[model samples]
Target chain A: MVEQHIASAFDRDLEAIQAQIMKMGGLVEAAIMDAARALETRDEELAQQVRQGDKAIDGLEELINEEAARVIAIRAPAAVDLRLVLSVMKISGNLERIGDYAKNIAKRTAVLAQGPNVSESAAAMRRMAREVELMLKDALDSYIQRDVELAQDVIARDRDVDQMYNALFREFLTFMMEDPRNITPCMHLHFIAKNVERMGDHVTSIAEQVVYLVTGDKPEDDRQKADTTSSVPQEV
Target chain B: MVEQHIASAFDRDLEAIQAQIMKMGGLVEAAIMDAARALETRDEELAQQVRQGDKAIDGLEELINEEAARVIAIRAPAAVDLRLVLSVMKISGNLERIGDYAKNIAKRTAVLAQGPNVSESAAAMRRMAREVELMLKDALDSYIQRDVELAQDVIARDRDVDQMYNALFREFLTFMMEDPRNITPCMHLHFIAKNVERMGDHVTSIAEQVVYLVTGDKPEDDRQKADTTSSVPQEV
Candidate 1:
């Protein structure tokens, strides 16, 4: 009877932690979209809000971790239950990192708001961030539903984000080569794009965690990176 | 008698995991130094070695995590022992990330080796990398010794790394403004500097984990960031 009671309590604890994960995921997705929108509209106020909102996301991660540790200490969960707790810790860490990238993008957006607009780059970055936000939404859904196929789909979509970042990178280089005045703004835009690309990578990591949670095995590390700016010869 | 045997087994498991952590730390330290030397000396072969060597570091992290999970499951360590296991998982994650940064520096080094030299930037980056390497060594030492003072010292030194990054950012901007030819090379060098700066951040995180492991509380998040490039006015 006591064993059954402890198991029920563990189930309740797991459910509560999962709920927190979803809430944190929701905040990160909003941060991504709002930061991108701020850059697109040059809305410094929106950018400031995104920056401030990250504190809540960070706090949620800490709360989730503490809760996970308490459950582990008190319940002594075994096998699959233990794996679930560990995966929750990792997913929250990924979410916190994604929030940080959003904060970085907002910081750069504030700086770029003072400079001249780099043509169409902000719009391009918004599209990229939009894709990442969708991936994160699906990634979270997969975790809640324990749907491996949906998580795999999210992993596959990160390549598109990388490709978008590479395009922005080359475009920024061309702009800088054309005009010295464009250099500073384009550099800032380039980093914002890079930050968004990293967001996709972290989203992919969350999806991978979902796969591990379901299968009890890590997915193969065969995801080919599509960001080639680091490798291409400096012909520009 | 049986309980004592299990306790000794758990101790053995913990010792093996810590040994792996030390080995991983050594590899990461070598990677940082090798990647920096490759950039400073324009040695493509050395850079390639650092890139390939990261696989070993990554493999060790995976191994450490598996062992940690096993220990947690079989031993079901509670309280302080459980915290030690959890901290090992997080520290390995940080070390894996630092290795990735070193690989990134090497990738950029291979590209920059083909281009005309940006004056003194590579050497300056080497100096920055050296500081992070030293900080990491101290961080790992503190982890093994459970020395909170040394960990705190490592945390404090990250500020120097950030200040170095800011100086490099401004210098890169000046070079780009002076000659368009310096734009591409300076951008690559700038990223290498930023990567090293991020390495410092990760080392600080490892040190923070050390503090947490020894003391049952998280250190205050009051560490001020000295990297002002993202926020500074775009006058350059």
Candidate 2:
């Protein structure tokens, strides 16, 4: 009976840790969205808010890692439990990195806000940002619900973001070519697209972590071996 | 007497592993060069050489990891010793990834070879490839020699590569604008520049690994607080 109580308490602690991870994910997703919105609307203050939240993301990453260490030392989790802690560590790291990239985009947004006539370029970027935001939300949802199918959807959706990014890259390049005066803003747009593409990669990484958490196996092999002829799909 | 024998044998094994790492670095560097050369010269045979060498690089990475695991299990190394083994594992992973990226470039070269004329676009890509090859060489040199100065040079030189990439990106944009027919080749050029940039990043990761190996502390604080500018320098 005492042992059951002890195990229950440890499980509760792990649940708390998981909840914190979800909270951090929510914060990061909001930061990504705000940064994107800031870029779209040229809202310098919102961009600054996203930039400032980076420290909080970093703090949460370190905090979760420390908690995980403590749990491992005390509970000595095995198999699935071991996988869960490891996934959390890696997932949180990826999330923190996503936060960093979002901060970078926000910084670039702040710079762009200082300029004029960003609406056209910003609209194109908004399309990319909205898709990436959706992926991030779904990936975290997959994690929270332990839904492998949702995670698979996130993985499949990454190629769409990749294709969108390629198209946007060409569009930005056209803007730069049309006028060298647009170089600075084009560079900022390029960075935004790059960050969003990386955000997709991070979301894919998170989805991979979810698979490991649920299945105890890596799914990378299947994806890596995908046919080379298959171009990433396009969406309206 | 028995303890002394075991200690001497362990030290000998450790030295052997170190030698193997250096040798693996040489192989990786060669692969990067050959892959890039194959692209520049359109030498399908050299590209084939890189393809054939992929197995060797994969084997080396596995060997390094296995040896590190064995050492950790048998010797129970702590502190700097622990850091050294960990560094070995990470550096080996970095080298393996470098090899994969090199292989990717080689494969792209194969595709480009299938095309006629290949254009000045290919030339631009070749230049980026050469820069990446140089960075790979310098990074590994720093790792093998433990020359922080060499690593610092690499860190600094990465910026030059970045600026060149940005310039090339601008140039490619113009090419694509002049003719949308040029988009595919331009896409290839962009991939080359990106691969080069990532090669620099891997080298820096190696540099960081070396620092951790020698210092037993990751330079995380330096990274987070220091110049968060473009990862590479911005010199042409």
Candidate 3:
């Protein structure tokens, strides 16, 4: 009877932590979209909100971690239950990192708002951020549903985000080459683009965690990265 | 007698994991220095070595994490011991990230080696990387010794790394603005500098974990960041 009682308590604790994960995921997704939108619209107010909102996301991660530690300590969960706890900790860590990237995007957006408009890059960035946000939503859904296929799909989509970032990187370079005045703004935009790309990577990591949680095995680390800007030959 | 045996086994497991952490730390330190040296000397072969060597560092992290999970499951350490296990996981994560940054620096160095040399930036980057390497060494030492003072010192030194990054960012902007030919290389160099700056941040995180591991509380999150490139006003 006592074993059953403890098991139920663990279940309840796991559910609570999962709920917090979803809430944190929701906040991170909003941060991604709002930061991109702020850049697109040049709205410092919206950007500021995104920046401030990250604190809540960060706090949620801390809460989730503390709760996870408490559960592990008190319950002494074994095998699959233990794996679930570890995965939750990792997922929250990934979420926190994604939130940080969003904050970074907002910070850069505030700076870029003061500079001359770089044409079309902000909109491109919004589209990229949108894709990542959708991926994150699906990644969280996969976690909740324990759907391996959905998690795999999210992992596959990160390549597209990388490709988008590479395109922006090259475009920014061309703009800078064409106009010296464009250099500063383009550099900032490039970082914002890079930040969004990293968001996609972190979301991919969350999806990978889902896969690990379901299968008790990590997926092969053979996902082909599409970000080639670092290796691209200078055309200038 | 059986309980004592299990306790000794747990101690052995913990010791084995700590050994791995130290080994991982050593590889990461070498990676940082090798990547920086490659950049400073334009040594493509040395950079390639650093890139390939990261696999070992990554493999060790995976091993450490597996061992940690095993220890947690079999030993079910309580309180302080549990915190030690958790801190090991976090420290390995930080070390893994720092290794990735070193690989990134190497990747960029390989590309920059093929281009017309940008003057002085590579050497400056080497200096910045050297600082991070030293900080990481001290951070790990602090962890092993449970020396909170050394960890705190490592935390305080991260601001210096950030200030160095800010200086490099402005210098890169100046280089890019002065000549279109310098734009591509400077951008690559800028990213290498940013990667090193981020390495400092990860080292600080490792140090912070040391603090938490020793004190059972996180240090206040009030450490001021000195990297202002993202928010700096456009001077061009």
Highest DockQ: give the candidate number.
3
Which residue runs does candidate 2 get wrong by more than 4 Å? A1-20, A58-82, A110-121, A166-191, A222-236, B1-27, B43-93, B96-150, B166-184, B216-236
- Specify the poorest-scoring 10-residue window by lDDT in model 1 chain B: B214-223
Ranking by TM-score: 3, 1, 2
Estimated TM-score for each candidate: 0.97, 0.72, 0.97
Candidate 2: tens digits of C-alpha lDDT, residues A15-58: 98888898899889898889889988889899889988988898
lDDT tens readout by residue for model 3, A1-236? 98999899999999999999999999999999999999999999999999899889989999999898888888888889999999999999999999899989898888888877878989899999999999999999999999999999999999999999999999999999998889999889889899999999999999999899888788776567899988987555
Per residue, candidate 3 scores C-alpha lDDT tens digits across B1-236 of 99899889988998899999999999999999999999999899999999899889989999998899888888888888888899999999999999999999899888888888878988888999999999999999999999999999999999999999999999999998899999999989999999999999999999999889888887776578889888888655
- Please give the lDDT score at residue A116 for candidate 3: 78
For candidate 1, state the interface root-mean-square deviation in angstroms to 1 decimal: 1.5
The most accurate candidate by TM-score is 3
Task: Report the Cα lDDT for candidate 1.
Answer: 0.92
Candidate 3 TM-score versus the reference? 0.97
